[model samples]
Target: MGAALHLAHAGQPAPGERHRTKGKGGSGGETFADFARQVYGDQRATPLARELLLAFGYATMVAHSEAERDVHDVWSTARKAMGATRTGRRWRLDEAIADDAPRYVSSKDREHRVCEAPRLRPHPDGPDDFRNVRGICGSLADWEHYALEKQLGTGWYKYHWFCKRHLDHLARVREQLREPNERAPQPVPNRGGLLPAYFESDWLGTYRHRLDSPTWEPPVYGISADDWPTPGVEPVAPRARLRLAALDGTLLVEADRGARR
Candidate 1:
């Protein structure tokens, strides 16, 4: 879906240049986009970050102009996975029977038979295979974690939490879909489900009460459904607020700075 489509549903005022919040006070800083990269690890986060800034009545920040070495190392991974194999005087990548898992071993060896494209050639190591690839995504170590978890996490059986997180990651990634990544269109939106939307607002309100009354701040912004306390689950004060200020287009920024410590 294009931003235009999203904007339609968002018939809310396009904040644009009209509601500029003040620059960060008392905290020395970077530009909004740069700060977004610092905290979220991506400079492209600038636009979304700008949205977040305005929600709270804060101005955009100044950020580093140069891309820092990405926190995740990607190069070493590329070399390992891309190396080809030789069989009967012909060389090809291994048949990696791919699926969407960070680890590729599902009993569901269902490769893309749609056009039979994957089966025709040896499987090149996927970009997610950080064990060898590099840059902008997946460090070698992150890929290695996938590989290691494949071996150790119940013989590559994924955790329920893994599936949940995968769904959220998939959504955010889809929101960023202008560029392609290893992620594919999901069969379904299997993340914690729409159930969280109901409690998310209320839970956050109480969480903020805990923060500010002592005075207020969130333990963390944007609580995942999994992290919520259940009925009779006592609420604990959150550590700090998340950057975004509102939901349903009514949220306002009441705090600043990315981290307290």
Candidate 2:
């Protein structure tokens, strides 16, 4: 803040400058730590510190991590900082996007303005004897098929309700048909309280025999003395003779070292 302003006032080597001075503000290629030290004469990387310097018109050399992305973007940051939406409450993505009631008034072909039809019309017959008829949208063929199906459940016709139902069914069917064969990775269950992870290659084959084939289980290291170290135990040997399972089998492995031999 003060440092950024001081640099600006000093006409100091601000970032993106053509000057060639050492230990100056915005010299070049400063990470968050580097930038903090250069700007504030301190080594702490604070969000407030970054915001203050950037707000005073400076670009950061560092990229924001993916986790912080949802609540922060260039557009929102700039707008909120400039006091553009001070009085009005800020609308998030959810608030900005929404469903609304169907439009009752719209231009008909942009030429004629069509008003809605009256819901109630005067009946020539007595009001008590008036019909409460509802709409049925179907062609003669549809009517014939529907009537036949109604009689026997024997025809290939769709009721209006069937359109939406059948559409939903079709969407599900399409998704089922389009799904790829690739399976999602399951958790490794961390039998030893380790991260569940995977590599794409066949290095796992080295441990496969112990995991899958019949073997006497070791009590301390389970079935994997090849990898995991036992709890509260340490080995004195150097790591020189350790054999990593090769994904590429073409490379000839070195002999077990003389110490082990």
Candidate 2 segments whose C-alpha is farther than 4 A from its true place: 1-165, 171-261
lDDT of 2 by residue, 1-261 (tens): 011111111122223333222354443333334434534542222344334334322221222112122212422342344342334664221111110100112111222211112225443444453231322211122111211011111111212221221345334533543332123122111131000011111223322331342332322322221233322334212212212122232111111221110
Tell me the deviation in Å of residue 14 in model 2: 18
lDDT of 1 by residue, 1-261 (tens): 001000000111132312122253423232333333333432222343323222211121222111121111211122133334454331111111111001122432223111111122223586454323322222111211221112221223231111222344434434443243223321211122111221122334433332333233222312332233323433333222222233222222222222111
Best model number under TM-score: 1
RMSD of each: 22.7, 25.5
Worst 10 residues of 1 by lDDT: 1-10
Cand. 1 Cα-lDDT: 0.24
Local distance difference test, each candidate = 0.24, 0.24
Which stretches of model 1 miss by more than 4 angstroms?
Answer: 1-27, 31-34, 39-239, 242-249, 255-261
lDDT of candidate 2 at residue 252, scale 0 to 100: 15
